[model samples]
Target chain A: MSRVSTLLARETALAWGKGGGPMVAVGFYAGVATLLPLAVGSEPERLAAIAPGAAWVALALAALLSLDRLFERDYEDGSLDLLTLSPVPLEIICAIKCLAQWLATGLPLALAAPVAAIALGASPQLSGLVVACALLGGLAFSFMGGIGAALSLGARRGGLLTAVIVLPLFVPPVIFGGGALASLEAGLPWSAGFALLGAYAAAAVALGPLAMAAACRNALS
Target chain B: MIPEVSIQSLALSRGGRQLFSRLILKLSPGEAIALIGRNGAGKTSLLRAIAGLINPDEGEIAFGGVEPAEAREAIHLLGHLDGLKSSRTARDELAFWTGFGGGAPAAVEAAAARLELIPLLDLEVRRLSAGQRRRLALARLLAAPRPLWLLDEPLSPLDAEWRGRFGEIMGEHLATGGMILAAVHDPLPLATRTVEVGR
Candidate 1:
């Protein structure tokens, strides 16, 4: 487990440093969030209302943007085939890749939510909840998106294909994430939403890799 | 002793496309086999199936004397990409792989030198020529201590010199009771058994 974690960390660091995709996605998230205020103009109530939705959307988009390259590059280059042949099961490899992807893209998006929230005139308390929801919710997005990314390898227009395949699946996270934030704002218990989000993440963590391994097998075949 | 790896009546299909059907093969320690086929002939698929990358639809593969996941610790597969991330410097790639491979750094460095990658260690993999990348990939294989090597198109872009060097290394590996299954289009300069696919 430690070995897998270390490998995941190392791979994530490498991907974050070398690939412009993650950075570009984060940049776009910040850029879009920053522009929202200008477009809306001093409407604090309006900003607060739309802030959670925008943040959720941005987080999802950021995650989706990085999904296509998750395994496609390795698959095309034959590295994924080698990974399957590793002494490690493809499940472990997929888990490691997901960990890396979440850390590289999802974690950063979570951390960046505060900035996005502030840009949309969210109060400090609401902003904090937004970040929390994003931190937990974004992991589920990464894991689920990984499945789409892995399955779409070798498909024509893989980037577009990834988005098309993954977007419908992403609705769960988006809904629960926004609901969690709204519940927090309304002084309602947000734990249920958080719990639901956590459950999704857990399920994705447990089953996503196996699905990905099957997808890889299909792609190779 | 039982062979290091064996497959019986292996059949594989993906999305209803039958990539391979009823394939049978085996490899004992100290044996080397070459897989030959035309493009789309399933040479890579065969290597992948043997390495457990793809599950066979109608057969079983046993490694050492057990299942693939059970015998994974002793198996290594090298595909066309060499699995090296082009963005990473060769040294960084080696360091990262060594961290997981559990092999000695000295041995890896020595293999790098022998492969003439010493000077290019700091260069990113993307900067290396195709032949260089192939050698670097082979160097990685040398660094690993696994007993079974499943290679796909192992000699795609090598010149005559590197090809000879690869042959020598493979010969040495076989001499040491290591098993090798390589997919190649041309003849390799070693005592080898050939398996033709898509017949």
Candidate 2:
């Protein structure tokens, strides 16, 4: 497990360095957060109300934007086949890859949220909750996105196809995530929202790998 | 030692296209076989099936008399794209793969030198020419310690000198009692049996 994790980390780090897409993704998130304040004027109440949703939305988009490269590059380069042939189970590989994706893209976005939230006039408490939700929700998004990424491997216009297949599935997390933040901001019991987000992440963790492995088999077929 | 690979009545399909129908082949220690076929003839597909990268719609494949998942540690496959990650330096790529294969660092370095990739070790694979990339891919064969080798179009993009050198490597592998099944368009300079993949 440690070996696989190490490999996954190395691969993800290499990927983050090689492609401008991840940087662009982080930049785009920060850019969108920065721009929201300018567009909506200096109204703190309005900014706080929209901040949580905006942050979650940005993270979701970032996760989606970077997903197509997950398996596509390796598939094109034939390294994916080597991965499949490795002694490890495909499920373990999928888990590690998803972990790596979350670490590289999702985790950074989560860590950056408090600053982005501050820009959007969110209270520190609300910002922290938003970050937690985004971390859980973003992991779920990447887990599900991996299935789409593997499915679209080697297809014509694969990037667009991946987005099309994956974006609709993002709706649940986005809704639950935004609703969770809304409840938090309203001082209502927000555990339900957190529970839902946790459930979604758990479900993704349980089933995402199988779906990814099946998609990989189909793509290779 | 266990025989490197054994296959019995392997059937595979892609998108309802029958790639192979009830194919049976076995590769034992010190054996070398060439998979010959025209383009789209399922040569690469067969190699992929053997490597366990693609599951057959029907039938089974085994390495060392065990399922691919069970015997994966003993098998090494070089598929159509050479399995080289272009974004990484040659040294980093080799280091990662050798580590994955649990190979020694010294052995991998020596293999890189033999493949004449020592100078380009720090160069990213994407910056290397096609032949250079092929050489790097071949170097992987030397780095890892595995009993069974499955190569798809191993000779693609190699110049004559490298081609001869690759043949020598293959010969040396056979002499060391390693088993190889390589798909090639041209004949290799070695005593090799032939398997016509597409009929």
Per-prediction DockQ: 0.53, 0.60
Q: Which of the numbered candidates is closest to the native, going by highest DockQ?
A: 2
State the lDDT of candidate 2 residue by residue for A65-105, as single tens digits: 88888888778887777877777677878777877788778
True contacts kept of each: 0.58, 0.65
**Which lDDT tens digits does candidate 1 get at residues A23-79?**
777898987787777887768888888888887887888788778888888887777
TM-score of chain A in every predicted structure: 0.92, 0.92
- Evaluate model 1: give its lDDT: 0.79
> In model 2, which runs have C-alpha deviations exceeding 4 angstroms?
A35-42, B8-15, B19-24, B56-64
lDDT of 1 by residue, B145-189 (tens): 678888877887999888888999988888888898888898866
